[model samples]
Target: MARDSLIRHYAYLVRVVVGRLVPGGKSRLEVDDLVGSGIAGLIRAVDTYDPAREVKFETYATANIRGAVLEAIRNEDFLPRSIRDRLRAFDRASLATEVRIGRPATDHELANELGVTEEHVGRLRIAAVASRVGSLDDSTSGSEGDTLRFGDMVADPSVDLDRELQDNEVREALTNALGHLPERERTVVGLYYTENLTFLEIGRVLGISESRAYQLHGQALSRLRQRFRPMLMAA
Candidate 1:
């Protein structure tokens, strides 16, 4: 079947599926948002739908709609500053300690290198672990798996050489700027981008609440942004 026609035919099913999944909540997501997402999913599904398959369209379209909505959320991107700072700190400390000692930094070594205690190092390690262990309310309007994919969820959109070059430039600038940041600042930056840890994870790493982690991270980022405005703007 032609993709457009197939989608138009089943688009109503998409809305029905999304409505069933994400009933209204305190969230700001609109039915139209889910409808749009479902339609996109249906189009994709049409390209791949099998005529012989006994499975219902609802089951298949549900996945597509959820995927689309999830993709949008991923694009909207929820992250906390404390998370970013802890990450930056961890990245710098690890690399610096690794090069200085010619090996991966042990918890003891990482702590000593950063002028913190072994317990503190362990906190950072806990923070660095990748998991969907969020206590945050992640329930959505659909039945899609809500597992966190951190860096994997980050979409890459380099459409051309110029864009790619700009991305690389931005990455390089961030690296240099991160290298120059204080440990707290560095950790937050690294946690969010490199370690792919959550704000709560960062708080665990730094022996603070997730909220505190956010505050520190914001402060660190604000400082970095103020200091590196020219370079960042150029990027």
Candidate 2:
């Protein structure tokens, strides 16, 4: 197939793969930008394709396209180092608490363990969320005796809702928590996660500085964490 034909035919695959990785429709990258990056991957795959390996072109192309998209996302990570370190500390603390408890730890429990106030813990969680970028790719978690994976939820996709909604209790809790956020916080959440906009883009859209966008994101996450500690901790 000609390069142009290949691009046209497989272009949708890029959207599918990238869309899944950045689900919630809240990506800073536009669809056209992602597609263009995938096109670059497709061209590279075509030029270096190895037919002698007996590999299917579709499989090879899919890997290349997803990698290209993820690479582009990685290049755009702009969180400060201090924020990253803080996020890491919070993650570590949460993991430690979970290991000891064999279940999700409440904010109070985590606060006690970390020797911080509950408010501080909530702030840390929000900060962690602000600093991190979620991935649609598979991830493994859970206690040592029982491992769970984001991919495992798909064993019964119709019922599991991809593990995101598997726990009815958590889902309801999350919805309630989201509903209680301030209007601006809700908007930031929708724009950042649902629209996939970057902080700068979100700032521009909301007529705020980038720092303000970051603050709102953190504040929203903090508020949600305060209300949904059980659900958040379990996940």
Candidate 3:
């Protein structure tokens, strides 16, 4: 089959796959970029796929497309230079502290060694997390295996680049909003969303009721959405 036909037929598959891979906040990899990568993977699949084989083309192409996109993400270090440097320093300090204590260092212990406040350490952890791009196969909440890919959520063919720029704005807004959350709410948000814990698990971790965990989670998201609403409207 010609590549063009394959692309037209399988384009929706790319979006489906990419949607699962998209994260909630600001991300360096856009849905369109992932779709483009999927196209490249599809073309490669077309060239190499064999009809005589029992394997379905969609299955074959999906893996190729996902692999291509993941490869692109893995090749890039999207974190800003200063944050990257700080994370590296943190790692070194952690290892040294752990070796000295014969145990894993607490965040505060590592913070003291690194000559920074515990709060600074916490911010660095969040910044490092915000900068990472995860694999498509990683399981997400709500939609079965589908992750948080927002390709379908913000579909504006006429303003893709503008939307992409807005993604950055949204990320900045989220980072700032997170800072304003009450300490417990912020911790709950981080544990439930960022760490992918269940509400029950989060409650257990925090020694609170599961319903309370749910409440904190809801409040955190409400605050974040409210904080980012202006940026979303402008975008």
What does candidate 3's lDDT look like per residue over 1-235, in tens digits?
A: 5678777888777776555445433243565676788778778877877666555677666655654554444344433445445545654565446435544456588679988887665554433233332122222233223234233222211112233334443356456777999999999867755576776788889999877886786676556555544332221
Model 2 scores a C-alpha lDDT of 0.54
Give the runs in model 3 whose Cα sits over 4 Å from its true position. 27-29, 78-235
At residue 187, give the lDDT of candidate 2.
90
Each prediction's Cα lDDT score?
0.49, 0.54, 0.55
TM for candidate 1 is 0.35
Q: What lDDT tens digits, residue by residue, belong to model 2 across residues 1-235? A: 8877877887777766654544333435454677778778777777766777555677666656655654554345454445445544555565445434544466687788778887776565443332222322112111122122223211211111333244444345446667899999889877765565776787899999877876887677566545544323322
Candidate 1: misplaced stretches above 4 Å?
A: 5-27, 30-156, 159-168, 221-235
Instruction: Show model 2 residue runs off by greater than 4 Å.
Output: 27-29, 79-235
What is the alpha-carbon lDDT of model 3 when measured against the actual structure? 0.55
Span of ten consecutive residues with least summed lDDT in model 1: 152-161
Measured with C-alpha atoms, the lDDT of residue 27 in candidate 2 is 34
Q: Output the lDDT of residue 133, model 3.
A: 25
